[model samples]
Target: MKKIKTVDAIGHILCHDITKIIPGEFKGVAFKKGHIVKKEDIEVLLSLGKDHLYVWEKNEDMVHENDGAIFLKDLTAGENLDFSDIKEGKIDFISNKYGLLKIDVDTLLELNMIDDIMLSTLHNNFIVNKGTKVAGTRVIPLLIDKNKLTEAKNIVGNKKIVNVVEFKPKKVGIVTTGNEVFYKRIVDKFGPVIKEKVEKFGCEVIGQAICKDDTIMIKNAIEDFINQGAELICCTGGMSVDPDDVTPTAIKESGASIITYGSPILPGAMFLLAYKGDIPIMGIPGCAMYNKTTVFDVILPRVLVDEKLTKKDIAMYGHGGLCMNCDICTYPACNFAKV
Candidate 1:
């Protein structure tokens, strides 16, 4: 249904058989409107399966089918309200499965409801840093009441909203460091293997090099990648403590700062993270060549989005290992590897 008039009211519904239901047990409530309809209270209603609830102003369009409800006061049929009048509030678009949150302040400010501009920027999804203009009570939508919008803007006080930093993808350089593969003792499988994995992200391997276990050669290869505009670099093989193992030492000698030597994760505990300035230089273990997933799998997403990684960020992988490759894997639609 088309929206008609501006309004501000809580809309909700019973997910259960509310036709003959108790008040507290079956109903859900929410005050925020015009954005995503997801809320914890709605999940409880949907669990009942048989019951479906919706809330909307008597004069406005119905709440979204995906949403739970919209509460409205006494009004006659055929009357509607414009959504522009309703002040915008916290919008949570992150899916429950990912535990992630996406905040769009541009959409919030367009509605003329941001009261405390500074504090609202702190909310999850608000995510803007200092010097970023989040909202302005002074600016009002055309043809709308500036005074009313001003009143709604004042409601937002200095409540701090959490800022979530997002990662953006950077170009990567892959240096496959192994003699057996480089000298044709075995097929050049590592190159194609890593290429496929990196393709799943926004990163591109602009340069590739093959080097033996000589630290000097490896370090030179890394510098070559930096010269080629590679912000991220990966050295495959030679990660263990074998006498010929030199990938870890090579990364250290390249004048790049090491972020962490290893991670506490399965199938990828030997992973290494180092950086030259903000550019990350990683050492991928041999296991990544054969395994369906590994530490590179975890870091790829962060690298794609240019997000900073912390030890705690790496720790989140333990809960993520529950993934079992499905018969029909829906890559983007599923939470299998959006890490």
Candidate 2:
């Protein structure tokens, strides 16, 4: 591209957009790139404070911002992802299905480390509905060196940086324990809460079995669900260390490997996660019965996708794990479980 005085730029093609800003009323591109400058337009150009302008120089070694954004999009997009048309040198990634949005943070950081290149995305592991905007990519300048783009592609190297994993509606089983509920001394509120939470993630509650804090009965209920082809099992109540709490013990005796029994998250410190072969069984804490969100909400998406949670994964939640419990709750959009 070449620069010229605005007064002498008649007949020359613009190399970038000319923006017009009204204090509060409007802000938009007044003149688009590639538009041929006319003799009569000089006054308007000068009024927008254009003392000088860049004109297309048709350099084969340089790539325009629009084309650069498209190149970057191709390297970052993966399954269940779509992209918007390039505008003002920017392209947005969109989710084509309701699923979990995940980003290769390591790759994203490396890409942003490059000069004149940027890729911004949502927090990793966010649940997104169809048509959600997940990320955006663009170049910092009107044009970029082709060599720089080559370096970006080499860094990406057949790996997709952004993706959405489709959620499978798994059959779920619920085991509610506590003498207060099992003996009908109090209304059983835990079963309904757990059922509602899982169903929203496309999981079906096959059945709910209430147990009287008895390890044997809880274990039997868990095995029964496994025999019934329950892909996921949730055991609510009796998770604390109280002598009467036996949900954790029952989960351990149910032939499942315990991943972690506690989380760093506040309201869900007593949470437990285990796997019986490939089926996931969780000892849901009391927090889940009342709190709007918990560690269970953080781990639920991964479990729904059949991805087993690791001890390290649960440990990472120590940072930004405390929920403010605001009067107007905005989760998944807030910092909770953002690790």
Candidate 3:
């Protein structure tokens, strides 16, 4: 950078900030560093009593901060994601629809490791709504090596790193299994909980079945819902190992393929996930009816987005599967936070 007369500084990059002071009104930088001097800025600089200004010397091998920020935006943005307008070498990722937010964690780490390059994002596997800020990127210095950006681009290849899978509202069926509930000895409390949970994800509860512990009855109830065009089926209760707990068996008998019947998460260890054709069938444990957050809470959003789960996928959830059940319930805000 070198000093140049303010009048000649037009079309030159600013090497330092231009500070402006107003009595009792404002006192801050009027033009930030790295701002390219425009023909109009000459009058403002002269009025601020600036005779000379420091400006960057152009280099072909290096890119300006704002230009580098735009590169970062292209490398990071994917479908259902938008980027903020560049500001002082910084840009942020915004969601364009409500759905699950996913990131390539390994690639993100590798990009941040590059000198003068930075990218940050919310943790992977999160439910984000439209207009939510999910990630941000910024160049660390006013100028950056162009080759470093090429390395980032090479890492990105054809696929952008961050994205959101928009939720698909499904026609749902609820199967409440328990002799007490089926016989009306105890009021049907589980159905309301499951309905509210599914409805929150925009699923329509077409119908419900109150079934006894008998396997045939439960299996028939599930098939009945499938015959009625239920896109997703949720069976509540009788998920434990007790002799009377037969929901898992009934689900198998109904010809659905079980993905993972048990999870490594507390308050949801007995949770089951299966599918018949394209429809998802879940066996929710009793704890989900009482616990503010559980494995069901973690997995349901992915299901709504049509993420086909395997045993390996369910096993990967163990790392952050323990729900803290915080009193305030700032869920989707933290790894272990849930309502």
Which model scores highest in lDDT?
A: 2
| Candidate 1, 1-339: lDDT as tens digits | 222212211243222223324567854333222333345444543454423334333432323322211111011001111111223322221211211223344443543343222212223222222234332122221112334334433442332122234435467788988888778687766778788777644457797898877899999999999998988888888988788998888888988887777776566778888778888888988778777766677676555556667667666656654445666644334454323
Report the candidate with higher TM-score, 1 versus 2: 2
Ranking by TM-score, best first?
Answer: 3, 2, 1
* Comparison by lDDT, 1 against 2, better one: 2
- In terms of TM-score, which candidate is strongest? 3
lDDT of 3 by residue, 1-339 (tens): 898899999878998889999899989998999999999999999999999999999899999999999988987889898778899899999999999988888888788888998998888878999999999999999999999999989887777778998999999999999999888899988889888998998999999899999999999999999999999999998999999999999999999999999988876999999999889999999898788788888889888988888898888878777877778777778776221
As for TM-score, the candidate ahead, 1 or 3, is 3
Score candidate 3 by TM-score against the native.
Answer: 0.95
Q: Which ten residues in a row have the lowest lDDT in candidate 3?
A: 330-339
The worst-scoring run of ten residues by lDDT in candidate 2 lies at 57-66
TM-score of model 1 (CA atoms): 0.53
Question: For model 2, how does the per-residue alpha-carbon lDDT over 298-333 read when each residue is reduced to its tens digit?
Answer: 888988877888999899989988888988778988
The lDDT per prediction is: 0.53, 0.90, 0.89
